[model samples]
Target: MTGQDTLETGESVRYISASDLRGFVAALFEEAGLPKEDARTVADNLVCANLRGNDTHGVFRAPTYLERVRNGLYAATPRINVEETAFAARSVDGDNGMGAVVGTRAMQEAISVAGQCGTSLVSIRNSNHYGMAAYYVLQALEHDMVAIAFTNSSPAFPPWGGRKPFFGTSPLAVAVPAGKEQPYVLDMAMSVLARGNVYVAAQAGTSIPPGLALDKDGRPTTDPKALIDGGTMLPFGGVKGAALSMLMDIFGGVLSGAAFAGRVGNPHMDFDRPQNVGHLFMCFRPDLFMPMEVFKSRMDDLVATVKRQPRAEGIDEILIPGEREDRSRRRREKEGIPLSTDVCEKLDAEAAKAGLAQLNTTPAPFAGK
Candidate 1:
């Protein structure tokens, strides 16, 4: 699916205010069965995706999640249970709850434990897609702790050599405190690009860059639809990325005793089955390894030094990971999140099907600027 395939000629796009969208999604989740607080958490996470320019995992996924809930695949009232041990490690059973809610709870638990133990690990099983991994890691930053987060998803890409899909676009995120600069964050999937990026490119009728994905038969292809239909995504930078992805799978999937990529069901296509996704979270109090003040000052110096490097001819400055995203988020929060015509239509259809009032398409408060 390319841009031309989805966008009609001369069709204009409109923006949706984040607060309105967040409220609507929260209402939808509550109507579908989640508790009010849990619904709010899930909605916030989903909206954050759009705010950060990751529309593929944003509200676009709500319809599928609702369908799964209605189909009895995901429990409306989940019973998340935890098992703790002596090693400052814990395991949580999501009991088929919304991944975002469960993941947030897991991180909360990890942070709490880390405060007591100086470091802690939490693994979650039987969860679903949890939106961006960075959101959960950032939660620990408020506690002045360094954090790591990982999650496994449905099989969308193949192992390095094999043609068959055997791994999810497993992702890892890390956050570290800094003194003067913004907190340092790194979040990325092992794949060359996120599946959401491929879908967005396909919707825009654009060819993906080379080396991103392969067609169904394992041949490299720039067409986005090829990636959607039984194609494989290449790992970033070859073997190293693949190795990291495998490691994430082990920590998030295998260690959590949850289904790995091949065994986990796809949420997009398999509406009647639980995704059984897994996640790993860890928090390390800076005071545990070094003085919090010293660590933060060092991080601030590191960021400043990197920003001082020579830039390309047209570029003014180099951006560390999460810097640009943080800027975009602040701007969008005040300006509103832009939704392409295609996404707007999809949201409207979902509203109609769910027997809810349609979102107003008129220019919202943050539309123009």
Candidate 2:
């Protein structure tokens, strides 16, 4: 939802700077019981999502998180323990910690082990929503590794045939290095759109595009509120996407010893229960399979070829998977992130509860320009 509208009361919305918003969130987490480092990490990840134009996974989720912490559904100081196994694979028990912190730590371990054994697989259980999967996959780039990351969440959609929800809006991310151009990164959910997107649309009083979601009775719906309440998100490309989601559930959830989609409870509205989300991370040292230089060169060539493809009548340029997001991130980092009025209100309430000073109400230098 675009943050452009005037309510009946004729009040205009204000946007908060990304840094200020993140600082406010960090302070709230600190007050809620997270350690300084953990709080900072979570704050950075959330803000990064906003900067990258992924509002669904961004600071917009702060209110629900705060509510979860307040209700004891999430522990501020969780003990993240690792259980090692053969084949360079490991299992991580997040102990109900913030997903960003747990995901970062897990990817670090995967990178380290992959450096030694050529490849490593790490499965994590009991973590919360870790924001964008790209965040973790990109972490492996510095190590000259190809990274793959996946996560399974509460059921927001059904399996190919079934009416009831049975699969999480699972996401998959892959990152490949490039020589001169930006790294080739692909991050996408198996569903047509993320559940958070629907919420944002609903809050802004907008209707979603048709065929993206299904109503409570399993009929196609365009109403965001209906999709948010009991509706199910449609899988991308029908059965193919649903199949991939199931595979992600197996690799991320079952392998991590965490509950599957239908088994895991919703964390957004349910503040008193754990979500038991799961994630899988894999990193491969390019040198082990092929020369790093060769991989990077091929990736650069591939990206250039795709961008050179003919465009449609109205299209000016062909875009790569992560190109738009990377550009958006650079722009937002220099300017500031945007927030809807509802999100701003929630942030203000959270800041007050944590005894943090209110954020500046001025719009970011780059907003609406």
Candidate 3:
């Protein structure tokens, strides 16, 4: 089933089943030269973003991914290697593989080491764009472990007070499990919002909200196109966010022996060069200091306690981070994912270029009320 949302501005959004979208994306990836397993892995990560309502990181990225593959910037089949293995830490070289594939392997190692040592950290370098950070951390929830993930990307933002672009969005995500409650997941970019969101807006011909971006001269602007034209993104909370972004750049990039600060290449801008992005994933058993059940109970209690707090003016209820996304995922699973017409058109065009059949352009409305 599917649903349609008509904007006041007369834009009509069509909802496509997640399974359908995933299959189509996988087919496209295969046609672009990825192994069938790798194709499915990439498809699953992108569809997960769509299910969580983060369309900026979803199937819309297929074209650029294929372009990189064709340009020899992204390796369709990579030989990822593990180096400097320790009791509780390790480093990985991605061999320029797709981030989803590299990240899944790295996170699996973290989970394995954490199972034996109570904690583990894995650093990865030379990977291409990894989909939503939450996808990796959420893997730890199944093992009753807490997870934290971070990644650095090509420079698209400046230092706190400086005007020159110096760091990528540098995203971070954390996840913890709770008994009888949805796991808490917090995923966010250090920037005000992901740079991909600006690209999405540009494709949809929508205006970005004021203050989210600056023109090439560092002057605030609402034009999404400006971001594509060498503009900079504003950090989420100015100095604080900028500082956190810098930290991610240092640990996730520089310390990992990947590209850092301005040295990183952007798949969009520095297409001729490799991105050499870096990621960090850490996981630990929540029961390291307490019983697993005890930790889960306390987490549930904390969520309930926060929900019972006095409501603020005009606010319905306080929500835990990732709650909205969980809700969105459930709703989308039943009603299908809403995609802008512009996005479908782009996908259709990409499929044609890849010698694959076009995806269904019309969304199927949900059968239920």
lDDT of 3 by residue, 251-336 (tens): 88988889887787787677878889999999999888899889989999998888889998999989999999999899989888
- Cα lDDT tens digits for candidate 1, 2-89: 1221223233456667889898888888888889999899899989988876667788778777788888877878999999965799
lDDT assessment of candidate 2: 0.83
TM-score per candidate: 0.93, 0.93, 0.95
Off by over 4 Å in 3: 1-4, 7-10
lDDT scores in order: 0.83, 0.83, 0.86
Model 2 TM-score on a 0 to 1 scale: 0.93
Q: Give the TM-score of candidate 3.
A: 0.95
On the 0 to 100 scale, the lDDT of residue 269 in model 1 is 77
Give per-residue CA lDDT, model 2, range 276-353, as digits (tens).
889999898888857888888888898899889989899998888888999988887766666666777788788887
Point to the candidate with the largest lDDT: 3
Candidate 2 clashes: the total is: 0
Q: Extract clashing residue pairs from model 3.
A: 2-365, 2-366
